[model samples]
Target chain A: MIENMTEIAISQLLSETQKMKYEDYRFVTASCVSLGDDGCDVIYHFDKDLEMKHLKLRVGKGEELPSVSKIYFCALLVENEMKELFGINITDIAVDYGGHMLLSDEELESPMAKQQITIVEKKGAK
Target chain B: MSKTVIPFGPQHPVLPEPLHLKLVMQDEIIVDAIPAIGYVHRGLEKLTETKEFTQNTFVVERVCGICSCMHALAYCQGIESLMNIEIPDRAKYLRVLWAELHRIHSHLLWLGLLADAFGFESLFMQVWRNREKVMDIMEETAGSRVIISVNTVGGTRRDISKEMLTKISVIVDEIKEDLKQVEAAFFNDYTVKHRLVGVGVLTKEDAYALGTAGPMARASGIKQDLRMTGYSAYGELDFEPIIEQDGDSYARTVVRLKEVYQSINLIKQCIAKMPEGEIVVPVKGNPNGEVVSRVEQPRGEVLYYLRANGSKTLDRLRIRTPTFANIPALLHMLPGSQLADVPVLILTIDPCISCTER
Candidate 1:
């Protein structure tokens, strides 16, 4: 119905649901990087499967997007799991700002966080 | 009267798996029920992305020990469909044979557990004693007691030898006879009927609306069996779904009991109709595609959606287990029933929280 597992389908679904009167869908989780670094994996699980199709929406980073979970219920868990697993943050949605069930408190920074690697050496042959 | 909230289990005597239930009761009548899972979460979906297609069999089989073979078969079938691999005729029949064997053992295990839940210790022992036959057969054939890692990407790992087949058929006949005794003991027992009948009444609409599947939905008069779609060798076998119209706890017990008989018959049918061919095909190349597979697990319809991206690992794997889908429906059926009926009613759907959480 919503373009069979893609980002455009997510946008189309969000737009269609926005036209309806329901307005409680909140982003519970938003975390995931695509395999080849070409796209992202966004899991938007609506309490009512009708409100939104459960999808792994793939898109390039830094793309302008409309927040969709605003029209669904209980998406916090999906967002939380994603955030914990992928380390992607949703600026627009209010987050609980803690580690999820999968990760411990001490290991808050996700393992998958893409930190730049810098090597320093005193004396080396070029 | 103030209602008291009692935490039944993440580990309780009644529940086998680690499922925490918050029960709010007013004078022994449960008013509200909240199910909290995630205790047994193993990040299985995440594991699929790291493990190779062939290596994922053992991992998938451990999803639920009782439905191990079915889960492995489902995962393999998903990959098989994606690769468009045509399984050998013998492998199909062997798969069907093991599937039916697992089904019978699973139902018997549930029946035994249900009996114990109701304080019928002897019935529990009797049913489990019968269960050992299938377990013995599994151990003898597959070389493992619970997680029979028989399934592979293209076909199965174990093959039933002609000599083993004859012995299996003979033992199956013995199990069939033992089942008739159980059938009489269960159906004729007044206490069993008094405890189960009309306790948990799920109407047909409630069953469908709540997305209940497997025996619970079948018991409620909804003719939905994944086998009808003819996955595996079910199309070749001669069997019909065991259905009951009462939609009560007792009806569910009856349905499972009859299904045990059907599974035995179905196993025999597989033996009679098995055609000779290779047990497994050598799978090469990375599986790269999306495929959806449906299998009739002991509980209900289990849906697996697998996406592979031409690598040693999968791109994404989504599992919609039967108990996960049936939980909402079970919650709806709980409020109106008496407190004592809770365990029996809960068992009616055969709650497999491990399968659900995984």
Candidate 2:
């Protein structure tokens, strides 16, 4: 509902996020919403002087998305979270965890993914 | 010099919440710090998919025990926006009252934890002892000590009577008096000053770049606060964001300590200006849109993003907790610091792993 929310291409996410930084907009947070089998929507929220701007990106499975951590270091945490929990492949993270940050062995990994059980069961069998 | 890797947490005496930091140190100085969380992750955000809009209020409240009321308020505000409901004036005032109370209690809890971190056990006991008064106020009004589940979709679930308001005012006065002593001890005590005065310095530029929130940013002279957005009854209240230019551990301490007094004043203003009206309005229809709600919690800015599809359960619920935002700031501050001062630096941000991992 926020007027400043703008949808951008997956390729433009890094550039747009860098532009927000140059415009003095603080990187607030990032979120990922599953769009079923069509892939997921990654929403990046930014703010300056209480005014907010959201940049959304749509990416499908096997698609590699650029990381924004180079522009905003704080993005690393959320990016790693998205990679681990949502199974999004965020490439070139400034501080790459290589898929080991929040999730552990006892937990259900990538529960937000559409084929969560299949992925986990496959990994478990190994 | 040889390098050593020290795992700071996941089980530490000073940390009440579980947060693991892998500190790469060169002798006594930290070279790099890598943080690992999710020990307390309950996947509460995912729970919103199965819970109804009304029931999800409670689910969000449980996201963090310290700032439960703010979580509920943010969730309710998002849902209220979705349903296009204008909450009653009295409900807004009541929400602010409970929110300020939560702030006071949360800061007090953090101050106590900081004291314990520095081995000031007696100070920690005294701070928690005074914190009990705020807990009593919450229990008396909201019927719960920590997770005061008074927030609903259209309005609040509970209301305070006129007599109860007077009693709360009296208790707040006593709390203000008690906080003065705690403030003096924190600000003037030699040990606290020596340990915290110049430690963990995050300059204004670094703070802005790192996107630190609440007292962490305010302490660094950013002057950023979500309360300035005037959500709930905050627009009607008269108060200023407590700012400190030092950007050190002591500055962060001073900001929180002074904000305790500010919260007390805000609560008083809410009590005096509270309008007489219905507390709860009947909410109709399921939400079918998206909304972003930001609230200033005791720790910092808590953001909630909600999306619904004309159904009882929400489609996606994302909570961007303050501690989650502050972790990067912590990572920035850890390097170039002595190993022993790590606890103080960690506590300076008032990191809430429960909220971060939720």
Candidate that would win on lDDT:
2
Residue-level lDDT of model 1, residues B227-286, one tens digit each, is 877889999887688888989988888899989888878888898899987899988888
Clashing pairs in 2: none
Q: Whole-model Cα lDDT per candidate? A: 0.72, 0.89
Q: What is the DockQ of candidate 1?
A: 0.09
Highest-scoring model, DockQ: 2
Off by over 4 Å in 2: A105-108, A117-126
Candidates 1 onward: DockQ, in order: 0.09, 0.76
Q: What residue runs in model 1 are displaced by over 4 Å at the alpha carbon?
A: A1-8, A11-126
TM (chain A) per model: 0.47, 0.86
lDDT of 2 by residue, B1-358 (tens): 9999999998988898888999999999999999988787898888888888899999998888999999999999999988899999999999999999999999999999999989899899999998999999888887879998998988899999999999999999998988787777899999989999999999999998998999999999988888888899999999789999999999999999999999999989999999999998998889988889999999899999988899999889999998888999999999999999999999999988889888
lDDT (10s digit) by residue, model 1, range A45-106: 32222123344566443333344434432233344444444444433323333334345444
Q: Give the clashing pairs for model 1.
A: A25-A69, A25-A70, A25-A71, A25-A72, A28-A75, A28-A76, A28-A79, A29-A79, A29-A80
